[model samples]
Target chain A: MTDLRKSDRLIKLGLLMIAFSAISALFVITLFIFEQGGPIMFKYGLKSFIFGQDWYPSEKIFGLWPMIVGSLMVTLGALIIGVPLGLATAIFLAEFSSRRLARILKPVIELLAGIPSVVYGFLGLMFLIPFIRENLGGPGLSVLAASIILGIMILPTVISISLDSIRAVPDCYREGSIALGATRWQTVRMVVLPAARSGILAAIILGMGRAIGETMAVIMVAGNAAEIPSSILQPVRTLTSNIALEMGYAAGEHRQALFATGVILFVIIMVLNTIANLTASRQGKR
Target chain B: MKETAIEVRNLNHFYNRHQSLKNINLEVYRHEILAIIGPAKSGKSTFLTCLNRMSDLIPGARVEGQILIDGQDIYRPEVDVVALRRKFGMVFATPIPLPMSIYENVVYGVRLAGKNNRPELDRLVEDSLEKAGLWNEVKDRLRISALKLSGGQQQRLCLARILALKPEYILLDEPTSGLDPISTMKIEDSLRRLKQNYTIILVTNNTKQAARVADRTAFFLMGELVEVAETEIIFTRPTDKRTEAYLEGKFG
Candidate 1:
């Protein structure tokens, strides 16, 4: 009995230590980032850093308006293109497609997600950029190219999350709707989609975050211009790619400004994550 | 001499290669409660689902049967399955109200069928809730989510959803199995009143419930219909020894 009690105490202590260590690691990372970036942000004033669009290292002037706008435009474009296709694919997989077709398609979608973002960027650069340049009459790298590539990259996430949500609905719900004289598509649109609304929203928000934070792919195709473009065909610079491209060479005040951009990007991602978490909980409650 | 509401002829069903229901024949009279009683997996639920074509919803399920609703063959290729289902609604064992407000849950079927006028929807919601015996309790809280209701109220709300469709026939698969005694009694009372206008086919393992509410009772064993007779006869002096043994608690 004494031996068992000793072992139990030891296990409890081990678990406590593990939990404390995990939490402390997270706290340490957060503190380190805040300690490095907070003073610079306060000195510059958060509003000017956010609203000022001019980002010139030589003149020591940095603003994020263009970067923020570029991120929004690209993410919105991706959502516009990806959401309907993802929803359609999810509905087909969940409701209409035969088992064999679903079996074949689901793995293909997973594979699409598994392909490295760099590979996608390379593919976009080689084929899609040239196609746009030849056909649409613009430079190879543009916001349109970045948006198209990001949309494809995020398609798998949207389809997978929406499919899981739709599948999570009870079989009885479908039967109930069908028993009410709803055709297959009608049941999907009226019953299944509404029931999976929060989950679908969560999926879209996650995709939006991915589109906004994506760096390497956007860097390869977005042309890295620090100006808000008038059309999709023009070049732009997202906050993530701007930070990645200049962070290594930047020093002193310039580096602090780059870290400030990192801080802003971090805030945006945090907000997106909070929204995703809220919707996820709402789905659970439903 | 009563007008038949449903006619089942040479019905057989199989789950994959396993036969779950054998050749069966029966007729359900209009405005009467017909109860199906059986041991677990004796194909009672299967038979009830076949009446409304719900048995075929699952993949790898096959049915060899002819079910006629009002002299029209439901199994015929030209018949619209959706329309057939709309005319014959179902209630499952567990309460499954849609994830919406109480009023929306009640009128979901109507809206699905394209009735969107607010006053018409309100009337149907009130009438269905009243018929299901839930209006008095939920009328004030109609805007609240349906899932917030008690288990019994959720079951009744499901009933109201079906009732809103104004189906000629209602198939209930153990509608009261999950309810407390009082809620069970409420459901039974609602069914009693509902049978004045709609035919009801109920499947249950609760023989006492069958005796209490069913006008007629059918006993099933090993996917076969053992006997069907008036509820009193089936309980008090059944012709089939299997039913007698079951009712006597000898062995299932």
Candidate 2:
């Protein structure tokens, strides 16, 4: 009995230690970001710093609207390009393609996802940016470049998630529809897509979060312009790029302003993540 | 001779390298309920799916058979499989309604066949629901999700969905296996009424159910047909000793 009690206590201690490490990791990360950027933000007033658009270190006029708008525009552009393509690929992979074709295609999609974002940025800078500059008459490093690169970067996430959701729908639903004399495409359009709608929506939201929070790839391609871009061809600066670019050199009010931008970007991502979580939970219940 | 609703000639099927159905031959008359009775893995479901070409959905499944519906060879390359399936529908042992409203589920078949007018759709939905013996229970909640219905109601909704297509032959593979006694009785009653307008081919493990609703019964064992006779004869005075042994509950 004493030996059993000692073993039980050891198991409990191990579990507690695991749980503490997980929570401590999360807490430490959050606290470090706050500790580094918090005091300056409080001193400079978050609202003025965030809403203000001008960022001139010499003149001391700093606002983050251009950065926020740039992030929103680039994310929107990525979504516009990625979501439909991802959904189409997912539908083909899950519903239309033969098992042999699906087998061949699935790993290719996974490989696309596995490639590092920096490599994608490099490829975009080397081939896509120059091609667009020659063909579309745009700056080599433009919002369009960032958007297209990020869109390709997030495609695998959307396709894989949407495919899993579509596949999760029981074969019975497909058989039921087919047995009713509905064509395969008709069944997919009318029954399968509707059943997987929430999951597909969650995929899109996750893709959006990935696009919004991406820093390294966007910084390499986006022109780092402080002004809000009026066209995809023009240079722009996103919230993430702004933080990464200025965190090293910024001090006092300028550093606080960049942190304020981070806070705003963090809020947008939180909302998106919340929506994805809620949708997945609701789909689970169904 | 009376018109045959379905004809199977020298039917054989394979699942990958394994043979599933062997040299099956059968005929189903119009407006009659034909029951296929067998123990598990007897290829009864395979035979039923062959009628509507559903067995082809599985990978590595191949069929060497000729299935004729109303004198038309269904396996001919010129024949439209989708249209053929619409004319000959099926229901599984477990009820599976599309994830849609009750009204939508009922008219799904009709809509797929391109009948889109609102008034016509509403009429079909009402008529099909009534025919499936579910209109009274679900009339007030036609817009409610079909998943919200009980298992029995979902089964009936699936029935209504198939009925709305106006198929000449309806195939049911153990349609009441998952229902309670009352629900099973309700389904049996519904099938009896439905036989007036549609021919039904049902596969069941229950001897009593075969005796209850079948006009004729076909007994199968180990992927081979053992006996086919009128329901009364098969239950009370089976010609084959295997059939007799099976009816007597001696090793199905």
Candidate 3:
């Protein structure tokens, strides 16, 4: 018994060490990014660094307002294109389809997520860009192309999570609604959807995170033009694209500015994740 | 003896070929409480669900029967299931207060039926809650979450939810199996009052409950109903040997 207790204690300590190591790594990375980027923001002045549009690194004009707008536009476009299709697919998989069909479709949809980001970028560049150019009358590589690619990339994430949440609703709610004379569609709309509301909202926020943080695919189709786009057809640049494009040759304050962009992306993701957590916890309490 | 509210003839039910309810026939009279008592897996719940066609929700559950409510076949292909369900409301063993307020829970059925006038809904909510014996306790907090109520109150709220539909027939499956004795008696009292206006069919594990509130009682065993008779006759002078054995607690 003593031997067993000693071994258990050693194993418990080892696991605790591993857990804290992972958490401390996150803290270290956060500290490093802020440290590297903080001085640059101060030297450039916070307003000029964030809101100035000109991004000519050679001239030391580091205004990133256009990239901020670009990120927002692309993310919004992805949601507009992805949410309806993803939610419909989730509802079909969870509520309407046979178990055999859902079993077949769910894994195939999840397989889309395993395809490398570069592969998606290549496909978007080769096919979608040209298609958009021919049909919509802008440069082939434009905000529209990036948004479409990112939207497709996030479909698996949105559908799988939403499907899980929708399926999590208890059968009692459905039975109760149906027993009260509500049709199947009416039951789904009035009862199941409300019960699964928080989870679905969390899924959408997660998808938004994916859309905002995606780098390679957005870069390939987004033209990487440092300008605020006036329409969906125009070329644009995102913060992720900005870092990826300039990080290789950047030195001195230029490198620090790239780190500052990473800091901003990190903060955005943290905020999204916090909201997702709160939504999930509120659902748990209910 | 009285006008039949429901008649089941030559009924059988199967879940993926494992028969759960064998050939059974029963009749429920208007404005009468018919209690079905049996051990677990005796098909009492299945028989109750069949009356209102709630069994249709279970995938792979196949039923072949003629269940006539007011002499109209409920399982007919062209029957309007929604309309049929509106006429026959069901409450399950577990209390499922929709994740909404108390007032909303009572008016949920009425709203689905397209009655949206606020004053009309207010009156219906009060009447239903009172019929369920919950209005006096929850009248001031009708806007609060139904889930925040005690287990007994939640169960009564579920009863109110069904009452709001003003159904002609009310089917309850072990409605008090999860409740304390006081709560059970409160529901029994409500059922006694409710019987004046609606036909009630109760499936329960408690034999004494059947004795206390049921006008007639049916005994079931292993997917077959052994006998059904007046509650007094079934308790004191059961005719079937199996029903006698069950009432004596000799074997399940």
TM-score of each model's chain B: 0.98, 0.97, 0.98
Query: Model 2, stretches more than 4 Å misplaced?
Result: A32-47, A276-286
Q: Which parts of model 1 are misplaced by more than 4 Å?
A: A1-26, A39-45, A275-286
Candidate 2, residue A229: lDDT: 79
Task: Report the lDDT tens digits of candidate 2 across residue range A47-97.
Answer: 766777687755767777788889999999999889989999999999888
Q: Whose DockQ is greatest here?
A: 2
Which of candidates 2 and 3 reaches a greater lDDT?
A: 3
lDDT of 3 by residue, B1-252 (tens): 599888989899999979988889998899999999989999999998787788888889999989988788889999888898898878889988888899998998899989999999999999999999999999999998888998889989989998999999899999999999999999999999999999999999999999999999999898898999999999999999889888888876
Ranking by lDDT: 3, 1, 2
TM-score, every prediction: 0.93, 0.95, 0.96
Residue-level lDDT tens digits of model 1 in A62-181 = 778899899888988888888888888998998989989999999899899888889989999899999999999778688899999999888999999999999999888888778777
Please give me the DockQ of candidate 1 compared with the native complex: 0.60
lDDT of 3 by residue, A1-286 (tens): 9999999999999999999999999999999999998889889998998989899888888988999889988998998888888998999989889999999999999999999999999999899998999998889888899989989988999999999999999989999889888898888888898888887887799899999999999998999899898888999999999999999999998999999888877876788689778877887676
* Number of the top lDDT candidate: 3
For each of the candidates, the C-alpha root-mean-square deviation to the true structure, in angstroms, is 2.3, 2.0, 1.8
For residues B101-207, write the lDDT of model 1, one tens digit per residue: 89988888888788899999999999999999999999998999998999999999999999999999999999999999999999999999999999999999999
| Model 2, docking class | medium
Interface RMSD of each: 1.6, 1.6, 1.4
Per-prediction DockQ comes to 0.60, 0.76, 0.68
